[model samples]
Target: MNYSRRHLLQGSLAAGGSLAAFGDQHLAEELERKLRGRRPLGIVFCVSDGMSQGVLSMSEAFSQQVRSQGTVWWNLMSSQKAVMGLMDTASSSSLVTDSAAASSAWSGGQRIPNGKINVDEQGREIESLGETLEKSHLRLGLVSSATITHATPAAFAATVPNRGQEESIAEQYLNRVDVLLGGGSRFFDPKVRKDHQNLFEIFEKQNYQVIRTRNELLHSKSEKLLGTFSPGYLPYELDRKHDEELMKKIPSLAEMTEAALSRFLSSGDPFLMQMEGARIDHAAHQNDIGAILHEQLAFDDAVAKVLTLTAHREDILVILTSDHGNANPGLNGTGSSYRETNRSFSKVAEITRSTENFLSQCQQELRHSKLDLAEFFTSTYGFAPSANELDALMERLSGREVVEWSQQHKNSVGLLGQIVGNVTGVGWTGICHTADPTQLTSTGPGANQFAGLIRNDSVRDRLLRLLPI
Candidate 1:
């Protein structure tokens, strides 16, 4: 990084002590001086769902250890090209918010109750940012590492009473979103839907080019595209990198972002696009440090791709943030020694699969030899437990015991998480969402409006103000 960039980041980090320390008057002065009378022709909002600041730090350390450079998100911070802020992610019903309500704040300019998407508690549907952009004749696209109809992306394009009504959300995307990419093939297939309606056929009837693999997505020429590479959520990045078949079938978050940008920009019309790294939340909920680290890295790479496309262009506005925090994971001192925490993350690269995937494989091997289970863990994670630890894990893996243990240990994915944490020194507070303020960063036109402390709903209002309509 350049000298000025380094100086700016150091100053920002010092000023960003905590959300409580950020005063409103300072923020008002900064916005007044920097954001007045600015307009952008297009907007790209990128979300790393459930990303806490601790996750970003862990990912940066891991990236520097393995890749010899920090992640692009940190690079943007160190380059002083991004404006940073903190967003309070609370729903109308509670201080802690789920993905649906958290993202609805950004999509609808208000915080609805948890589990509803762009629908108020009074049973009225609010206009989403996607609808507002479409009214101005700007193209809109939604991409995710999760199912396309999942809560985070669905909030932007669909209005539903409950997030579980994914089939209905899938139908709404047909006419509303120009570029819809990600998984959830089951929701669109006739055989899987309760009504037996083939949503993909309906999309094709309306002139959408459906893509099902990485190669197809790269080569498609359609202006309107619907790509589903997995039946459910895509595989974790660590697993995808290790598996040849998955790498061929599944598109990375960065690849989907690039493809959406290609199709949207081709129209030469002002566009609004939202891309999500939905699996980072999933990994955090599981307390799988390796999975979350790789997912964050993938999300960071996608952010880099967006910055590259909008480089030196004042007409485009890019916003990067997260819905809320999950698990509140962080690196903890093993023995009162905070130094060399990076060394613990270096072993994370040896972890080729998620805790859930590895445990499932071990369950399948129970039909054969129990020794196979121990060997698998030892070889894959480079950690062999003591006799007592192996005995406890074996008890959990037995017939009826396994089900009860799984229910109680959902966050750890059974004993796998504890075993992994014992090796990596990463820790988690719980398996659910926390009421932590998420970080927000912005650049390009109207970026200054996002500096300092802001509410989650303010993101929607600022972007809406920039629309041509």
Candidate 2:
């Protein structure tokens, strides 16, 4: 490999000395069994579902946007190079893998068909990583920016037919889980759906303090607290960051990660947690550049959370990665490969969310009319518009009829590029998932299993090998 990649792998594996015993992949299984009852194995697995290669690269390029001072996650991600691998993201049926199958590659340690979570076609059950950890002494927790029942987080703890069977999924949490945080209040509130089963009651009956607000999530006395902050996915980080009081009310992905760590750590035994930057997927689906960037910033905070707690633990294994690439966004280019227009992403939050929201609403017309919507957006979002630009817009719209794109437009980056393009004039491909292998970075105990290139399922197998249920 080249020097840049080598630096990334070495920096991420700085604690390689502790995991030297598992260097032999052939011996990985035996090493995992040896860890079954000995070490305090802590696994913090992150799934950046639908996280495009573009988003992955962009987040690193602009890590400081939502970065806070004293965040160890930043330091850990910056110099720590992860063992980067490209896994074939194909499912049993299609070239494009859905969230369930993508997640199963890691959760079940065996790839399943799309729409299934660790289950065979006959519905026979398979042991999940969460069940294995619970079989051991570790605590269990699941958090995400999307609904808790979302495929990635649910893969570890729950199983069901339709990934949309969230109503039923909420009921399953009535068992041994300690912390469940994220959006999906709709799944808990029976009123939101006829069959939601009013799971808030079940969680309460089981002694799980159902927390609805941020304060409740922070202060709940019950060891098992279920915090469902939003009915759907939480607001974009760009929008949330604009409001200080609003930002504090709903826990960011990082805050949820911190809460999960604190609550799980109380078990006196190292636990397992999964942190997801779900919006990166949503933004990709909508091709919303602003949403994708800000949520990524929010996710970086969660990375910081784990880094803080594990910086001292030489045995904890922290893995970072995305499932698949979506709407591959990139900075606009110019002559020869369009390299000149590349934008510097110091911090994604540096761009206001209103700008993002407005861009999504009206971009195509701006392109055809040569009317930089950025000016209209500037005035609408509180910046001033130039007289020349205002005249250009008026002249363009004066007598010309407008054409609208159809909803069937499937290319995500195309949609996103059109919107963000008109706003910022950045160029990118149409919205679509790239079959590229994702980057995998790891630290702490059992990390040797993450060296070099490996399959996505190899990640879970490595964790299972490390914990030895």
How much lDDT does each candidate structure score? 0.82, 0.66
Model 2 TM-score, 2 decimals: 0.78
What is the C-alpha lDDT profile of model 2 across 1-469, one tens digit per residue? 4432333233334424245533455444443344433344577887777776677666665554444343233355566544444555766666777788778777777777788877856777767777766767567789998898888888887777677788766776666467899999998897887764778887788888888788877677777779998898777777787778767788778878888887666565667788888888777766666677667767877887777877776666788878877767776544466443433233233456643455554555555766556565564433444555444434433543223254333332343245445444344454556566766677766565666666666556556555524
Winning candidate number (lDDT): 1
Can you list the residue pairs that collide in candidate 1? none
* Prediction 2 global C-alpha lDDT: 0.66
lDDT of 1 by residue, 1-469 (tens): 4432333333333334344423555653453333333667778999999998899988998899888899988878776778988888899988999999988899898989999999998989999887877776778899999999999999998899999999999998876899999999999999999999989899999999998999999998989999999999999998999999999888889899999986666566888899999999999888888889999999999998888877856788888888999888888766446565656657788887887687788777876765465677787787787776666677776643433334535432535566677768887776788899998888887677678877887667667656554
Q: How does each model score on TM-score?
A: 0.88, 0.78
Worst 10 residues of 1 by lDDT: 4-13
Clash totals for all candidate models: 0, 16
Candidate 1 lDDT for residue 438: 91
